[model samples]
Target: MTTDILTVSCPSKRGIVATISSYLASQGCSISDSSQFDDVETGTFFMRVSFISEEGKPLSEIAEGFTRIGAEWNMNFEFHDSTTRMKVILMVSRFGHCLNDILYRWKIGMLPIDIVGVVSNHFNYQHLVLSHNLPFHHIKVTKDNKAEAEAELMAIIERTQAELIVLARYMQVLSDELCRRMPGRVINIHHSFLPGFKGAKPYHQAHKRGVKLIGATAHYVTAELDEGPIIDQETIAVTHAQSADDYVSIGRDVESRTLARAIHAHIHHRVFVNGDRTIVFPASPDSYAADRVG
Candidate 1:
């Protein structure tokens, strides 16, 4: 009854699936769900399997046993205990819609992540963040001391031992050094109005342009500022009659849901970065079951 997750990636070859499934069966594990992908263009293979150890074997032992198979196939693989929650750090600025939505989901156990702390450049949401019994660190950033500010932020990340950082609506651009240090650990969410609408009041710009679609993108943050590898995206149909304010309201909903979905896939080990794109596997059975219903 104890579920375990196994994720594997390697060069494309035949019998990869048979080898993995046979290995699991040999270890007395029952496969509950499985997803796989073979990228013909890249000649790469990716697989994620959710299974239960019928014999209640420890994760370390199972992982150790898989080394032979992994070595034979020249594969990069990981074995994870599904019950362990991923540690996460949330960074936000003035906008709190995505932050608020993630907070609600975490509070209700709908999101299985340990929100270790929140980092912010502004103090606007200090009270809101603290109310959740989470630590809040306020590190002000300016053009003059961006490097110093990043150092302080890195200290917090080290202290908390966070595995992932979510930029709900953090407005500051990260340095290339930081991006290179932790490649896929940071995720950011923003309204998808680029090229059509730029700075502040994007919804207004969309309204003026008579746009028929409004959307949001959640992606891994890279040095290129919003050009990171996209993990998820969602769009909503907009009518010409809707005002800019209506656009903002609808866009907020889309942003929250898209970011949440991306985070869920990430923490569940169902997402893989494949070159500039991604390979996101479907959720396993009961993966979305919340601890409590509102």
Candidate 2:
């Protein structure tokens, strides 16, 4: 038996489930697990179906055969081979917490993706990444070398066939061109609650403001820093008694966990961009682990 994962989204209509399940039954496919949602206000239907294809059916064949049904339902969808891992390329500079977290998750099979390479403007983490046998590139960037460095980044992404790019506290500002070209394929982690103390030393700023809570945000990387559609955010309450360093300590954990969750949602195709905001559907841990593409 061949296991396949299918996803669909379209205008809500009566009998969408019946049509889908009956079509699967007619094709001799057995449903293993399924989930669906109907947005009453928007009249949108969304579904994720995991099924086993009878012997002799492969993912490509199943995908090819679903065209008619997809067309009939006016669906926007994808058919994925559940076992294939998504290829990822990570970029970071100075900060190691997010990068370390992702690396550990990947090593432990918690994040089902292949980290193709690590790119850094500094050499701080070269030995740490090399210990895992993954390639690390050090292409220093300055005002004069920005173009050349980005060219190197693009070259690595192309050669590695990287489908998703993560900025794990990568401090450099990306050029306008790369942001447009990559669109929704990039993810970035910000250390503080965005739209507030934005630039550098966010923790210090928040602490100085005497704010009662600290937070982190994980969002898509667009041309504007910290302005992309947010995917996930988490907060940890604080008090005036805590210093900046204390905030930093607590903030690190929030940053890593928030980024991980956002990446998980992105990889699973559970997030949808709605203008400057995002719509993230609820997902269980098992459903979360199996389908994530990021």
Candidate No. with top lDDT: 1
Candidate 2 residue-wise lDDT, 29-141, digit = tens: 88877778887877788887778878657677777888998999899889877677789999999989999999988787677788999999999999999999999999899
Worst 10-residue lDDT window, candidate 1? 285-294
What tens-digit string does per-residue lDDT give for candidate 1 at 1-294?
A: 767889999999999999999989998999989999999999999999988899988889989999989999999999888778899999999889999999999988889899999999999889999999999999999999999999999999999999999999899998999899889899999777454675688889989989999899899999887888889999899998899999999999999999999999999899999988899998777366423356
The whole-model lDDT of each prediction reads: 0.90, 0.85
Point out where model 2 deviates above 4 Å: 1-3, 39-43, 54-56, 284-294
Off by over 4 Å in 1: 193-195, 289-294
When summed lDDT is taken over every stretch of 10 residues in candidate 2, the lowest stretch is 284-293
